[model samples]
Target: MRIAITRRGYITELDGVNKFIFNLAEGLNQLGCEVHIISHALGGSQVSNIASYAEKFFDFQGKFQIHALPFSYTNDALALPLWFLNGSRLINKLEVDAVIINGIVPLNSRKVKIAVNHGIFTGSFLNTNRITQHIYLQFAKHIYLYGIDLTVCVSSKLKEELGKLLNIKSIVIPLPLKLNLYRTEPLGKRSPLVLHVGGRSSKNAEISIQSMKILNEKYDLDVKLIIVGHKNAYLESLSAKYKYMVPKTLEFYFDASSLVVRDLMANAKALILPSRYEAFSYVVLEALASGLPVVVSSAIPSELVKDGFNGFRLLQYDPNLYAKRIKALLTDDDMWDGMSKNALKTARKYSHIKVAKLYLHAIQDIMRMKLNS
Candidate 1:
């Protein structure tokens, strides 16, 4: 079957949502489906320019085609309607068997329409105010989704949350991990590198910095901390603000590519994420795929990080506790090796092609039901 996956943002950037789109497209392509990517820009930039930059990110030379609509916007809230107007025209012309939308957007097409729910931001408890939370939740539940044949949630928690908030039923489908693109390195060959992917407030990046400080000062471990994310002023200032506190070293990577991140994971001792909220974490899966043990907070879903099995899952954002766990993974070779093995095992279950098959099955079932009805 022919399929087209749509996203409002550029797919070249390996953010969580973009990763899901690329991985799913690759998965469907591997399963003998003709796949196409339909995307628009966030800023006021032409689609051709973005597509040129996007070419470097795709490893699959010409397995699928990319369609960038000539639409750009500054405000995401206003972009929805613009996308509905321009995106519908482009998608309708594509004439694919199915179209899977990465986020909420309006489209009036007769073909099978699948809307993916990555998560609803009710606001982060660590950063957002109550009023902001209310407005975000109201917009997500009432305004984001409409005229879609099926809604696919990335996690069970997300499905439950949306069901309760919007009184809508949705199916759960986890994010896909490109296993071939991310390969494992020997545990003994890795450096003492701890990775933190996102720099958002909800990511609890400050906690990771504090924990690194504790790991250096308290444990006297000579490990390096690498923080990678999109360009953000607050995240960029973190290294300078805590320079003295974290006496060892802190490497900040802004606008890093997926290949760069995968290489970092290949040689890192552990991946630390103290997020306050997550619908599902693709970074955690990438770490697991690279055979790197993760030390994430309890706020991350439990099934992803199996405490003492794949990695340690802390209950809170306490720096000392995180320091202790990081130290344990760095110093103890036996524990590290064991966790690394298990991490790879867990990653196999979320392989890109495997998850894509699941998506295809769901799409087929729903299409048949719609036809019958």
Candidate 2:
């Protein structure tokens, strides 16, 4: 079967969404589907110097073909419309059997469109304000999905949220992660440390920092927090005085080359994600594959975490509670080892090949339905 997937364009950098698309395309390709990735960008060598507006074809790792449209405009609004125009043209030209839209707002396809919803943003889409963006999203419930034949969500929570918008249910298909590259190994001992990734307001990193601070102050705990993609000014000052125990990482797209982050997960005792809300955590899955226990808030969905199984869920959003649980993992041997084994077992369901099979089944069903219709 021939398949086409569309997503937002980026050149040398990959956010979570881009990485998800790559994994999906690779998975589909492995299933004997001729997969095509349609994206929008302006950087690579153009069709010609005068034709900065034409599409360019390139091979991505000899796995899938990338059809990138030349989008030159810097204005956010203008770029999207141009992206929509060129993306439609490419998908239509390819004559694919089925097309998957990576997210609600990425691109449009003329083929049998299966709209994949990551999550509806109560926050900003691009540079737009909250009020206007809300209205746009509300309108998008109808306007943006006019041609969609089906809708899929990455999580049940996201499906429920988007169903409230579209007034129709969608299937749940969790996102894929490369599992082989994230192998687990026997650990002699783990460092008394925690990892907090992403700095977005939704990430609620401040609360994670607060938990770390409480541990450092009152509990006489000697644990460290590895802050990635964000830094608090006060924590920076404190860590400086304390000899750089707590460290922050620059926000960059590591693509499949997240060796440093993976190393941290291997050595660290636990991964911390105290977000108020999240669709699904890629890092939590990655950490679990590395046999790293997690400390998260009660707000995180329990499908990915259990209160006392692979990881503990904070019954309340208390910093002291989080700190206490983290300290237990760091200090105890039996509890940590048990949870680490459970974490690895839980990660099996989310492996790349398993997730790929789910995607293949869905795509095949959609193609069969389209043909019958």
Candidate 3:
């Protein structure tokens, strides 16, 4: 089968969506499918040759073709309409069996078009004014279901919201993880280091820092926190500001390579994710695969992290609660060991190979239905 995947610029970035596309393509390729990446042309090295750039940054060693759109735009808003037009033209000409669009690009295609909803943008914008949120939701709903055969939501939370708010039906398929890339070190060998994967607003980075402050200062625990994500000016400033209070307890790694993140997960004692809203977190899954217990918010799907099993699931984004959990994982060796073992076991179920097969099944089922109709 021939498959085409679409995404906007910055394909080489080590973000969640980009990584998922690469991993899924690799998995499909291993399963003997011809995978083609349909993407827009962005600046920098990725514009010239995305395959080489992905290989260098994401360590993507897969067999696939990279088809770039002619024009490049730094602003996604300015680029999207053209992306839909050109992306549709490219996919229609290629005549692939299935077209997997990362987000709602509204590409005009007759193939089995699948739009993967990472999360509800309006849901994330709840903190904003009501008028703004309503406008965003209306605009999102209009474009989200256009010319798409199926909507793939990464978590049940997202799927439930899609059905409830936009009345769009979607399937629940969690993101894929490359299990082999993460090494599960023994709990005894790991340091008292806590890893937080995202620095975005929904990630609740401010609360993470506050919790780290409570851990290092209030509890006087000898632990360190590492925040990893793409470069954000706000996060850079926040890190600098928190240095005075938390001192050596917090560190930020902006635009770190995939290898560096894997290494950190391997050695960290626990992963803290106090998200305000989450569709699905690849970081939480990756941390579990690394044999690291996680302390996540209730916003995270229950399927991924079971409270007191693989990790603690807090109902609120309270710093005191997060600090309490981090303290236990860092100081209580026995509790940490048990949860760490369970974390590894939990990760086995969501391997990239299994996820790829699920995606393949979805694509095949949709195509079969189309043929019958």
Return the top candidate by lDDT: 3
Task: Give the winner by TM-score.
Answer: 3
Task: List the candidates ranked by lDDT, beginning with the highest.
Answer: 3, 1, 2
Model 3 alpha-carbon drift over 4 Å, by segment: 73-80, 122-146, 245-247
Name the TM-score of candidate 2.
0.83
lDDT of 1 by residue, 244-282 (tens): 645456888888777888899998999999987888788
**Of models 1 and 3, which has the larger TM-score?**
3
lDDT of 3 by residue, 74-186 (tens): 65566778877888899889889998888667677788888888877533366668886777667667776567788889888889988999998888887887788889888
Clashes of each: 0, 0, 0
Can you give the TM-score per candidate against the true fold? Answer: 0.89, 0.83, 0.91
Candidate 3's displacement at residue 100, Å, is 0.6
Backbone clash tally for model 3?
Answer: 0
Alpha carbon lDDT of residue 187, candidate 1? 74
Off by over 4 Å in 2: 9-13, 42-62, 72-76, 105-110, 125-131, 143-145, 230-257
**Comparing 2 and 3 on lDDT, the stronger one:** 3
Q: Write the per-residue lDDT of candidate 2 for residues 1-373, one digit (tens) a residue.
A: 7888776545323346665676676667677789877765555354222121211111123266667677754555566677667777777789897787764444566466777776665344645777877766765676445667778877787777777766766788777766766656555666667887665666666667778877877788777777665344544443455453334321122122366677778888888888776677777878888998899876566777887899998867778888889888877878988999999888877755566687667767777887797
